[model samples]
Target chain A: MTTPLISAAERQRIRSGAHSGPTAGLAPGHVQANLAILPADWAGDFLRFCQANPKACPVLAVSEVGDQALPTLGRGIDIRTDVPRYRVYRDGVLTEEPTDIAALWRDDFVSFLIGCSFSFEEALLADGVPVRHIALDRNVPMYETGIACVPAGRFSGNMVVSMRPMTPRDAIRAIQITSRFPSVHGAPVHFGDPAAIGIRDIAAPEHGEAVPIEPGEVPVFWACGVTPQVAIRNARPPIAIAHSPGAMLITDLLNTQLSVL
Target chain B: MTTPLISAAERQRIRSGAHSGPTAGLAPGHVQANLAILPADWAGDFLRFCQANPKACPVLAVSEVGDQALPTLGRGIDIRTDVPRYRVYRDGVLTEEPTDIAALWRDDFVSFLIGCSFSFEEALLADGVPVRHIALDRNVPMYETGIACVPAGRFSGNMVVSMRPMTPRDAIRAIQITSRFPSVHGAPVHFGDPAAIGIRDIAAPEHGEAVPIEPGEVPVFWACGVTPQVAIRNARPPIAIAHSPGAMLITDLLNTQLSVL
Candidate 1:
């Protein structure tokens, strides 16, 4: 049986156990976030990374050192187990993707929840602009660009961009809609010539499946959360963890509430 | 001789004599608008036309039957001769380009002042966004798009778009800035490939001179005020009048006051 859409409290309860899975279509209209955890020793650098590269890592909430609770982000959020799923990293390499992070918890671990494009995509869809990849039931196409992010501490890498094919009219409206939600990717970074930003091929996305573009449409690009993942790998932190792609943390905050105006 | 920038009263004094000339760079910081005077019998259709295409024809003020004064837009404003130049048309064909229209004033005339992109372009330049056309001292590149506007009554045509080349980063920021001034053309209608909208060549514009596109820059397109002129021609009104291109009516209203937020 398909699981019914549940309330935030109930969803958190499900996530507290072994029910970790993709948070898509769950808690509709509520904001979903990407999780990034690091040891306190590396927290300062990672925090700098998020601040310097806000489009890819819009920091929604951060917990103090040795703290597992993030009261500001949700109602009694247990950072160690609240995420639907998590990736565990050891010596800068992903070692495991687990449903529950209780076993991997450390006293010095700090948690950060970042704003995700899922929120702005929902906003765009609500405003009647069709999101291509979502209509085709595929992941949005993402690629690594030659354009470099600002280096902060030990975190820096070429930016990762997500692409959506749209007619020029819809693309303009999408830019207006997404710009209001600056915490999530904001307006598109580039359009038309993908190679101008260093992507060699339009059909060969480095991170996600490519969707078909019509003859009269252009591929609009936005900064992607994967940029931070690349930076994390480059930084080579002793220990780090992040939510697996598409497996985000469904939060109590409503997406509408994230709009600055 | 360069005339001194003057107030509403001073401009009115000069206009009272039916003085006609180009109104470029007049009354600095004050808003200038394009005029469309249609018979009262055809006013509703033209209103619908403007509503169907707000970006091209943002209605700033409309005068009542037999009233030539545009009080809302400026003090003691007379639609008959306030503008520096005018183009009078009959059966959709240009019949006269007069500076003063006191002799052609009619009781059935209903005047409209639509927002012009000049106001927002000034704002952009002031904000340090490089406006290529202005820098090159030429008209902005404009194209006839294959995209049809929402038809209203007898007024319908493909939209006209103006182009400027900008880097991806500035385009993102420009999107945010222009969104605040909806009274103007608002946000860009398109960007990137000109051919997507049936523009065969970016280097050859239908109206205005083409500006160079830097290696990493993309052409950003905004719905142009010329769009309404195209629609007006399609409507083929028995009698019509508009401000000559770049020869708008200087008004007392400040451009900054037009920001909705």
Candidate 2:
């Protein structure tokens, strides 16, 4: 069957349990976001963490306490049912992956829609800069860096970065293109030697599949959406939920709307 | 005596041969440009070259043939007498260094005011990023790279790049800051290994003095204004003129005015 044309249509398919796959290439021009749901008591601290470390956790929109709808991101975006898949965490440990989290919805839960790298990746591709992982049909390689995030209450951890192999020329263009979309991780946090940021082995990433770094290409890194997961793990608040990796909340917001330029 | 705060006053001093020194750090917050003058016969090809390779030869203002006044770049500015130093070339050979080019001005001469890296360097320094060469009181090191400039007519040569050694963190910030000012060699061309761009000896530059690269620092290269001079040499126009090394034309245009954002 042909893919749905508009975001609301695609979201309806996801909401109705007709689409449970990763939402990477769906809703071509819209913003797909990283999700984080926390208890209201822990939400204030998490909000502060996002503010303090905007590069990694750029909060696109935040839901009111106990509200499942993110009004700012889309029309009737019911957080509990709109995402294709969800990861439940209890005491900072992964409990289960489910198609829907309606049964586990909490009144005190606050939802945060963090900007995703997909927005900037679209920009890079549009500008003729190659995204290696996307070209190879593999997930972007992510690594845990030694760089520390600014501590906010109980949320603190080393920053996680997603790597994309590129020549220095393409990397420069990528930096310029991505800088326009600060809401989506902005410009790269690091480039060149991976060990400089404490990525010990370039081939073996802490998360995602390894992509080859062709000859004369450096591994350019951007702050990843998984960073908040690290923060969530550190700030264990009894129970929390997030979208399963690659199963982002496909919002009605256009990706171009995120560009500050 | 304290330096004059106004660009017109500074230009007057330069016109009277009172301030015949390096234009760097002078007329703070104003645009200083690399000056290039060619006969009307060779101007079309050179203009094409500048347009084809804007990162290296960003033409901020171009003069009408035989008109020494660059009214667009500054108020009442006479290119022939306002520059602190001028180098005249005959058949691609450096023939003389003159404080004023009024004696050599020809009706067929067409002048171009090209953007200089000084505009972005000011932005970097203001943002608290260390400019190594500025701190050491040395000229920024420039090297000829194997990267070729897009050929326009007879003008063709490898690009020349200016190097700045910075830690990866500061380099990322520099990339963002410089990207805002495209006229001033926007963003870096390459960072990390010098050999990657064909620079055999980082310590020894073909033009400008070498600055020390501290531990944990990588050399960042930007397209240099000297690139056009190399193009001029390759084209070998019978009569061509340029600002001597370190000497530039201080224009009334504020550096911030050059920022695209």
Candidate 3:
């Protein structure tokens, strides 16, 4: 096999505060994760929320209360400093965006690492299936769908889906490819008519910039990683922290290892 | 495993000239094939056509010239009389629909047994995926699409696809399931807009009865076994024979054995 363009060296650079930005397109072939840190008092509800809405928030690993290390995901990985950036939320409001959360780490803080879409997108591109937004160098279009996620305790909200435009033939292959990696939002939640899932305007997305849908192409939607952020906002815990958009926690795990087939 | 609804006894009954009609629901777990027999002179072009249009004419077995048996498909299976009904065409024109072809059998005749959609439909129904036409007790609707099959020698024509109405979620699961059985048409070629593939009237199919598409359901189209028949007519072979519509050759091979994964 060919050598990956990036390696674990990038994670070391990020750990040493040399890199502080979105981790997208960095450390190719590695599993990058969406991070969520919460107080132990609220961890139970958050874990239950992930279990209920698995497609949206497939939990990869959970740290012990007050522990900053995630040994299972990577070698000597420190959750407080390994990620490029973090967003601090206080009572559901954005409070701070920090590079290192060591100063603010609480004794009862628990870290949750959830799977991201990069893994399956890698698989799609490897199979020669075009990912429209990625080709155009734009964030994947995200929309709030009418389909409701199963609620757990205080976490109750509709699902958020990320969209990619593809021809019907490519979409079928994409479904088969993505189904093997259930940890990163398995098979698509919907395809074709956006209105069927309650998204009225194709040009206007709720979160990311809208990408062009070429002739003979239909927008395919997958459950988004942003769903947990929406659930967290609904829950309104006393304190919570998550990775900044696209600034993920790079892990030692290889993305291809996640394929069940 | 529990006993199949129809046993190998049905094939015995058909061989003994006791049964002569459509074999649709006769053998539950076994494979049923669409048969195409042609003169040795035309066999090469037909085989190439099947190889070119695999999704439409997936070849399950091919008999040697002058052979009347298909040993690989079943024990003591004689292709000449095993099928309940046969349609004989002379110079591209339908001449006779006969119960047995013993009188018309030629030493230079070659038989091609192609996969049928019944195998994958059984898999889909077994996995709890609703097949609309089956629920309504109607033939699966088939349409001629603008998508042309790759021309092989004298055989060149547009593809014929069968339609099944399913919700996007169910369609995703069905794609995953059907992909396992590539010999039986594999995954859907297209879904949603029928006009994208050049079918103008969704209600009026060229063959089979049209089943209703319920609200929130889209028509998923798979390459149809009828495609080879159309190709044969276009080729205008001096002599050709095929099984009558829905009157298939039952094989002892289990449908489950066709799954690649």
Best by lDDT: 2
* Model 3: residue B158 alpha-carbon error in angstroms: 1.9
Per-residue lDDT, model 3, residue A238, is 88
lDDT of 2: 0.90
Per-model C-alpha RMSD: 3.5, 2.6, 2.1
Off by over 4 Å in 1: A1-20, B1-24, B198-206
Q: Distance (Å) between predicted and true CA of A80, model 1?
A: 2.3
Write out the backbone clash pairs for model 1: none
In the order shown, the candidates' DockQ scores are: 0.64, 0.71, 0.78
Candidates arranged by lDDT, highest first: 2, 3, 1
Q: What is the lDDT of residue B46 in candidate 3?
A: 89
Tell me which of candidates 2 and 3 scores higher on lDDT. 2
Clashing pairs in 3: none
- Lowest summed-lDDT stretch of 10 residues in model 3 chain A? A1-10
Evaluated on CA atoms against the true complex, candidate 1 attains a DockQ of: 0.64
Write candidate 1's Cα lDDT for A1-261 as tens digits.
212244456556656574676666667787888788999988998899889888878899999988988777667667777777778777778889887788878899988888888889998898899999889888778899998999999888999999999887788788888988988778888877788889999999987789999987878999987777788888888888898777787777788888977
Q: Give a tens-digit lDDT track for model 3, residues A1-261.
A: 323334467778998999998776788889889889999989998899999999999999999999888888887788888899898888888889999999999999999999999889999999999998788877778898888889988887888899999999999999999999999999999998899988989899987789999888889999988788887887889889998877899888889989999
Candidates by DockQ, descending order: 3, 2, 1
Question: Which candidate, 2 or 3, would have the higher DockQ against the true structure?
Answer: 3
What tens-digit string does per-residue lDDT give for candidate 2 at B145-226?
A: 9999999999999999999999877998899899999999999999887899899999999999999898888899999998
